[model samples]
Target: MSEGRHEDESQTRPSGISTDVEVGAAHAIQPPRLENGEKRTDTEADGQNDQVELGSSGRNTTQEKPYSVFSTNEKRIIILAGSLAGFFSPLTSSIYFPALGTIAKALHVSNSDVNLTVTTYLILQGLAPMVIAGFADNMGRRPAYMLCFTIYICANLGLGLQNSYAALLGLRCLQSAGSSGTIALANGLVGDTITSEQRGAYIAFASLGGLLGPTLSPIIGGLISQNLEWHWLFWFLLIFSGVFTVPLFLFLPETCRKIVGDGSIPPPPLNTSLTDVIRHKRRAKRGLVFDAAEQAELRKNYRFRFPNPLATLWILFDPASLVILVATGLNLACFYAISTGASAAFRDEYGFNDIQIGLVFIPIGVGGILAAFTTGKLVDWNYQRHAQRLGITVVKGVRQDLTDFPIETARIQVALPILLANGVFVIAYGWTVGHKISLAGPIIFLFFLGYCSIASYQVMNVLMTDLWPGQAAAATAANNFIRCELGAAASAAIGPMSKAFGQGWAYTFWALIYMAFAPALLIISRRGIQMRSAKKAREDKRSARRKEKMNRKG
Candidate 1:
């Protein structure tokens, strides 16, 4: 049956009709229409069609394959690898917390000088992704991953051996530049392989490493710093990242849709994995070959382009994107204030040792873990509920036309309540810790704060992917840019702010600031569709103009 369908697809491809039509022939499904009522162009629909012809095989029959050509297990493995890569970014930051005082003393510098390293690490964290994300979106995820890991591994080595404050500050920025793009790339991987309907859950799962890093790192950092010296932290990061990088390079297949197109087309030799290379040899022996013409067709108009940091800034300036980013960035600023201040506050107020301070972070981490499990499923359920309410049929493994769908409402409805709850916890955490309440009192609030913060992050992460689609990495880079800048400021200011204002009022200020941004969510929910429509119309006009010029040249 598959062979017969393949033959039919081949015959139909020679004619002017799109391969999407052939794939949909079984179900009599029409091509999706744009907001303006025009059918999707052949180029737009080709991705779907390629999945049917090229992805249909022993395990992934054309009828059964999801929007991504990769199987369920394959997707899980890829996301896991991406998540591990993301893990190192936050781990690098948080692991240094327990050693901050030690490092300052060893280097004979003020504590504020050590804190400056943290601040600079974050600033680079925001800016570096802009440089890498455009490359990831245009080139491929694997190569970008390779580039980041290589830079990260080298920076860690330098950081481990460095003795001076100057060396520490410079290497930390280098480390930040190396590690930060992993989160953006991980988010991009989700966009590459998952559809919007199923994206909420997958995004949460992919984010587990990042969300858990802050939760878990302090404990590990405390253990290492308490037993050994501050330098071992970087040594640990170097070894750990090296272990993950080697396997990822060998096993993880490229998932960039532009480069591989739903995992159907073969990636360039550089992007191909060792496992994929082995599999390709076996397939060739079985008389399955990707002929020259097919390969050329896939490569047409796709060329290597220079990475543009400005592309990230461009997305930042978009009306809808700006609102979403600012709101999310404000939330991140609040989170940073809490996490960054916790070590100092706990040490000073509660008179906790490094190990005890590290242990106190457990509740927050626990909360983030719980949020990852619960919020993801909740968001998915919300998506389905909204689809049902709109009378839109959502087919598994098929991309839905979101042209008229209330996606903003579906995502934000789940987030708004979570954000409000988060604000409450932020205030509670501040007051409990400020009054020198029982350790348990603040610990409990920390958990809820962590839960609410990460849950809100998951929702926005998924929403950003939905909003930008193919440019998920760039969108996330912009998100990182805004939030990290705010976070850097918050990290630097939180100490002074806490010193000036009491802890209770300090967090209350952050809570109020967070709440101020809540209206941005409501605004986007109400007006996002109109903004998207306007943006799409403008994009379509530009596309039309380019095509007309190309035709005249021809």
Candidate 2:
């Protein structure tokens, strides 16, 4: 699904709207045209261009829009802001693990009751992002971002101060709702600004904060929870949100294509920074203002769209999209299941204490960070290699018509060998722990597991963004939803599986079953371009039927 495309409906026009298909692109990669029943207009004739560039992605390339490449500094800042935003969810989720027992003791709740909040958190973490992302996709990025952070701040404050089990349950749900939007919004911002050619590095940077958070949070939480009271965890979140997230979000200008209509259109006043607002106030005091056309342009562009959860979930119906979602989710689940079982296994098998078990987890985090950076570079490199080998002229700012490139081969193919190696580590790690081998064995395998799993997972993520360029938020929300569900399920089952079958057999089940993804990878890598073409065709046919019915009714 190499759909490096844009939603031209969101592009600004002189009439404040644009037509769907390019007027005269006979071979252009575009939505299927209405059947040619009427004579063509001379205006349409005049619009034809002789530029016939080839792209194997099966879409016509003639009608694609050219975009401005942001300067290095601007790119860095956008990724930085997005990465900071990405950090909050995992931080909020992981930092609480060390404090759960303390929290239960302070609130005088049963262990089971305390564990229920974790489940509640995971469930909301899966679902809330769907609703929040709808707004990010439809309305604007900045407002949605502000909304999520505000909810997060409030939830953290309440959790820190509250002393009831019921309050504990509710606040964690609220916290999950708020924090979960960061990854979706971060992906949206990156998609909004960067072209697919150069997006890999930026996606790595945007995701780095998420990887860093979970890795550091437990160690930090353990230290804080052991020394201070558990309430300080939320206090730390509150201060961090206030000091870091709020100021950065306030200064971050809106970047959604639906709202701003690409770089050519000026951003709305509200989307601008506090400095811009002050400058505007000063200008107004001096009686300076926009002319008639400018004012009318603002009026035309201003719109409010309510969130639609269904729309976010609908992408799963696409076969290629669904397969990618499930595979990535399960791969993520592998990590979650293993990590959740790690501490108990360490304690029982090696006689290690809580702090030692937590310390051993650091290598997994390091592996994740290393995987993101290294995989990002490899993804970009692979994309270019595929492009050149296929003879597509690689353009930096221009979205390449991926019609010709086998993107699955480019993104995921390179990672397959790595994944096979990862499976071996998965089996070995399980056996190592089960056999109570040297401590170094499990650590080494866990590190490799993190590296290989993340590398493959990152490829899937990049491919997803490319497949649904204009709907990055919804697509990401869907991805996150699947991963969380799988994570929860896998986390729950790991203990049972281990208890029932023993660690060696339990993880051997995982290793053998992982081969199931091979068929999906083959299907997607081979069939993605055809699936995309067929889906577009079906969409066009349905649209034509609807329009014909409307005409007859009229």
Candidate 3:
């Protein structure tokens, strides 16, 4: 067997224990052999004292500190900040739903022309993350977040003041560019702090704010547009975002593993928050400084690179990733079709006013909120069940080597049923609207639609993060790219489709499209590992060639 294959086998051995090297340690101590005469590496040893001696405040004092050194409480706080940041993306989009008609009237444009704003927003939403996510992965999450908020705040200011249709269209794109990257950045934060075993619940919690946006925004928008002018909507977002951005700027620390490395290494001044500076000062007062040599080494390893938008597209070249992105994108497009059509449909069919239209969205939004909490727990439970069945010992706060694990099965199994139910809900929701049935029929279907759609979306989110360990943001950005593009297309087409085929058939067509992608999930569950292994082999070969070229130059 090849030496690399031997190492892989040793790492994945069922009886092996997981461990980590002490941060700042010069070298890891060799581990003893197992009963089967297999030697363990430092990462496979049992009960090694791998503590990093920084201070009581920012050190990993235990051997089982997982892939990250941040405590559970710290991880929650970080994810919470990221979640709040992510909230603005969907909030900004959905809040505008109620104001679309009002804006169309004010700007002296056709409703179709106003709808172009939504399409452009989604286009930027897909494209902006391709740049920002790469920058976050390379630089730090804090800086990238600050950049997003600054741009968003400015765009909202312009949007609130602008009167012309041309200005409205341009500024909404700016608004999208500012808000869209937060979802991707939030996913990256989860990957930095949480282990895979705990990631499902953590990601779900992190997603709560974003999920709440669709649920709450329209009601808020309705109130704003009804009581005040449509311009007040942008002003409200500006003030709210500014208030939230202050706390984030003051408290949120840099959690990027590349820069901080499990919270032990101090980040550069550019990446450090005010709270980080204060913590370092306190640690310094006690004569506890981080090892200068280790800090220098981390800096050397994390050389700055310009954000490469093309890199996001490169993820699509992998068949496994492509399948996941396309399938999930189609699901999102179905959602867009429902959401984009709801306002007009309710206004026309049920004779509901703006407030009532917003109120009707409550069911779908509530469904998403419930799904976030429930589906997250289900995903985690399924992971643990898989671990037990595979005979792999899962240690809390320690990263599990999933090379031999059926992670696809663990995640997708939770989503497959949900996807099927979502299709049913879509069909039901369409016919209910088409028949001009009671409000309750569409409302009830909307609830289930939101529940199943979000549940399936959560599963895909967790799976994508797992597939790309360090590059969670980029993976999520790729997901956002595909989904948002499809959503834009769906939003543009839904009105025409509904007008031509009637609501019942229009949604039935969408339901069928969503179901068509269902088999792709099964393909992933069965062959994903083989595809991943092959991709890894190709990556390893390229790495070897690069080393050989550098050696020849030397």
Candidate 4:
């Protein structure tokens, strides 16, 4: 057998609790056989004292360390990490908005050329995350985040210094490439750390960033762009990004499936070769033992190359994922319709400046904040209500029986209101703007739209996360990919539509789209139980095959 294959066999056992490792540990003085054909020296033994302690007390000792798996404090920290990561995408997009007019003037470029920068940025922002999401699942969260953010930070620096539009577009793609990882990995990280019951609140926070970053960013960017040069806008982002990253590096523990040793769940295996393990052993003999889990983790399992992106594409086009795609797409179309419309519409009707335009986003912010803050309590309440209604109770956090309170119920409840509200407001805002209606009329309708949009958005996000329990990040990434792409298209196309068919007719068309998405929500809600049953049946068949294989081996 090849040496590399031998090492893979040796390391691929559960928890490194193999008979050989344990037998080696039983001996006190003799050096164990190193994979390199060298004996472990005394120096190495001294350094691995903590790992040796694993055998003490018959392997039953537990320490009440301030941080341990699944602790309450650690959960909060994980949420914060996920939230910080989610904030980067929207921050990058919105931060540039208030500076667009200035960039056009400074570069002596046409307004359309400057707007292309925005369009280009949005396009990449939609595309890059899907690629990054693929890597993150295979490589684990930490490597992906570190690599992506480094590019992001450098892109901002280049944006501050570069004068050419060509350079700016290239750098913006890099920035978007980096920022894209934030949303996918944030969802992945939450999956890494949180259980399904606790997932609702964490998902709520992750979804909240879609609203939070846009809300705060425009306000901050407006102030900077109005007073300082547009270059300072990037400087502010550079500084802000550092503030979050520094703390993350210091305190954010690695929660990747590879790093955290367990066998119940599967992750893409390590990418190390046998020679690498031998080299590590030699280094360990020189008084440099890698931390226990790290050494074994890298040695275990075969290295995975990138999976076919077609699998995700297949999943995206699947009936289940498609429902989410369309629901979220409408949500996106409606959301960007308001956000994009805000600048030209409000400026034309209410005569608001960039700062005032930024301020008007506060209603969306307020609406999102209220929905997210209460979603946890609301989700839990619904969970309990469904449990009681269905005559079931949870024991030690696991439900013995699932109640009628399916995740889709939340989708239906939220979607209906958002659809109706968004549809009405689109028509109202268009008509009110078409004719000279009261300035307050459009704004009032928008505020209600904000509340409804966010509530629906939250429900869809949480439902997607629930449906694909193990692969929530991939699912959410797919959702984001569809939503942003559609939203960007709508933002560019809406103006043309409004001009071609008049504002009233254009909005009536949008209302028709919103109304169409509503039935998708209802269908998911109605068919959820049957779909879940089908999924369970397939899993049972897989389990039976695995058992038959084991029986044959035995």
Candidate 5:
């Protein structure tokens, strides 16, 4: 390699190496020869070029940004906080189901009437995140988190105290609003803290909250309702919210990249770590002092602004994003629908009590969790494997590009079989349940059902984060919005469809629905390169324009 700077005024464009440089900066790497056979940098001094270039030594060097500022423990704590934050609404909703009959009887309402509350909760779950995600993405994750927790804590207290049916309905909606955004925020935090190559495992771990919530809900609810009063359920949630809220308020650092800038940039004082603050206070009490300048340096980079939720429309409208979103959304709907109908179907056919019915959900939860953890590791491994094969250098701790790296295949190809196999499990579960087979029959498939259902979500989620790491909160919120809306629909319809079509045929239809979306993944994997290239080109053009405008201003 040889060093050169572009100095020839006659050379106006790039020769084999044109890139949008900073305003007032000259090209650092001139081509070996121009198109007309002239050297552009043959007679130039160092000039005004601020860019660095390869030295005559021929050693390639790149200054790469470190992955994040937070320590490994800090990262785990962040993930833990995120998982706990996300665990509420779904778990609460499912847990509340066990108490539904008890509540209806105590309140002098029909069971059917109480079920409407579930519908309203799910609806609000879908709608609330539409606006709430903006607060996390644009405003600040900390404020958004505080706001949601405030609402959830208050709503749970209300639900516990309220004797009227309307209160239950309204409070449930409020609770949904408070809790549903946790998944989106958790996802955003992952984008904020983790690099693209490592996001899969982190995402899978974060998603476990959602998976465990519904899975554990019934068991907790059944025991509470079976032995104690029904209102204790809400009381329990209220206590749980308060307990979780303290750690979040005290220890959780704001990880929104828009405000924090990947931990390299310090966020505002408000976004500083509660744990750090507490440690500082305790240290000061012991006559110890730390460097104020060091503390101040971190927060100086902090900024605040309203993040637009509508910005997510860019990812949502993107063909690649849209396809994956739909696939995951529909797949989750099946999970919700099956969960909804499973209670009643099992109760009616097997003569199982509420506790026994709740136990049935454990297999799915266990399976889904196993899949999530395993899939995450595999996602990272698969990425490395693909990157190696594609000759894409993944410099350790640096976020590198795979623009032409066939990431679609790396992300989806292996997961495709896992996805397609899920449908088979669904159909099997349906038939087994329809025929009233042995208990182990349907339960075994539920495990696999849980396993396969989340494979696409885990894979696609990491991809979405990779696609737009900056606005990850917004992107995830859009995904949550899509899937929750679909889940609401499935939750509402599963029971009726089961009775109308018979479980066997009804599940067959759902199986086919999942299978129908498989082709979309295939198409996306094939065409993803072109899509990403066009996107990169557009971004490059924009960069060029911005730089040119800056130069004019200078």
Candidate 6:
């Protein structure tokens, strides 16, 4: 998806809420529009003027609303929905692990073959996000979420009954497809609803599910599998997912800019809506009314472009973003490595049963809970303190005069405890595990490891959203894609990697990698102000040029 193309277009009033399709452009990208009832160009307006202007492109360019106007109720709904949605995918992923053995035995497949099912699901989960955001960005949050839940339901049903290995593999992939959308949409919705100051806290809460789901899944799965048939796992997920979807359908208002006006930009103006316009044109051209949802042609446009699975590669390549990505990836990799390796390691070293294995995961869960609840308050305090130190207003008020706000201070501030805790605990955990130390040694380290990992994950998550507010979903999807890919690779290779290098030595290497993220954090902490100011300057200039172009077009 080009940064210049608006995600949506509607034809009705001359002005509604026109969102800049520009993701991180130095110029104002025009929203996709209709010209004489046909699709027009996607180029953005050039940045050469000093006032707000409309472009030949149909989008209305205007100032952005201050983030403070989001009502308490609105904020709660968005956060809760996002978090719940985000939680489902991870919940399903781990919940199925304990059942894998049973599934293999029932399907009459080799364990290794069954393991491929897990690997395939993981791959699909990582890949689904790159494309789903484009749909949510264009269609509306409600529809995208509906589709995700629909997929989730259907797959869970199949998963419960499937007897063949091929059938299981197919259904699992579909399940992952549904799971992918939850976190992807959650990040984007939070971006829509919260301010930079409060965003960390919001993300921290939403991320609870991602951390908790995995931590608790094995335990929950083990309990269910031990007492009942393994199929009950899917049955339970089906019921819970269905219940969650009902309220979500009823209360989850569209948070996409195209659906709800943010009070700054005017909506697109045309005589026909995006759907009607596209449908009519297609009928005129092909002598048939094309179905937008199943229209093979239209859907192709929404598919993930290959060769760049990480949609944020450009963003990641930027020296600043690269640093962030590496640090965040390290944070993710370390935790996943520990968690992934834990089950096998525990069974071999401590002779733990499935139930006992689940119990051992409690330290990680508790640590995550503490960090998640605590980080919210800490983030708010940090934001307020920064505001006071900088002599900026410390109240919930609009910034009516500025083209953009400084977001880097908030971004870098998160790195403080995130990098520190993550690095220290990882090394400690590794050292203890490597030495085959006492259970308390490993358990104590798990506590701190969970704390630092979740804390860092929350911080890195919010920072990514802050860096590119409009593209939060895609940005997060990109984060998910990258970190998950790295984590998956680590999972696939760690057994050999650890074996080649002693467990202690292997972890020591991982610890070194975790610590390496510190320099990146330091750079961002030190130079974040300059980078943010530069970004703001460019945005201001683009907004000015957009204003100039609009005047000329009018």
lDDT of candidates 1 onward, in order? 0.75, 0.68, 0.76, 0.60, 0.68, 0.62
Model 5 Cα lDDT, one tens digit per residue, 17-95: 1121111111112211111221222111112222233334576543322434455566777887887788896788789
- Name the candidate, 3 or 6, with the larger TM-score value: 3
Best by TM-score: 3
Against the correct fold, how does model 2 do in TM-score?
Answer: 0.83
lDDT of 1 by residue, 1-554 (tens): 22112222221111111111111111112233211221222222223443222222345423333355466666777887798889989999888887777787899998778888989999999999998998886678888999999999999999899999999999999999999999899987877777666676576569778877988899989888888888899999999998888989998888776666656467898889986677567556765454455455546635677877866877877877787788888888888888788878998898877788788888878988888888888988887776657545454545434565667888899998888888888889899999999888999999898888889988987787777765678888989998899899888888887889989998898789888788778888987777667766776676689789999999
Summarize candidate 6's per-residue lDDT along 173-204 as a digit string, tens digits. 99999888778888878766554555545655
User: Model 5, which residues run further than 4 Å from truth?
Assistant: 1-63, 108-112, 276-308, 538-554
lDDT of 2 by residue, 50-138 (tens): 23345455765443333422345655677788878879988887776656566767888854466567667777888888988877765
TM-scores, all models, native as reference: 0.87, 0.83, 0.88, 0.75, 0.82, 0.74
Q: State the number of backbone clashes in model 3.
A: 0
Candidate 4 clashing pairs? none
Better of 2 and 3 by lDDT: 3
The all-Cα superposition gives candidate 6 an RMSD in Å to the true structure of: 11.1
lDDT of 4 by residue, 480-541 (tens): 77877777777676666766886677767777786776677677777777665665566557
RMSD of each: 7.0, 7.6, 7.2, 11.1, 9.6, 11.1
Better lDDT candidate (3, 6): 3
In order of TM-score, best first, we have: 3, 1, 2, 5, 4, 6
Candidate 1's TM-score: 0.87
lDDT score at residue 226, model 6, on the 0-100 scale:
73
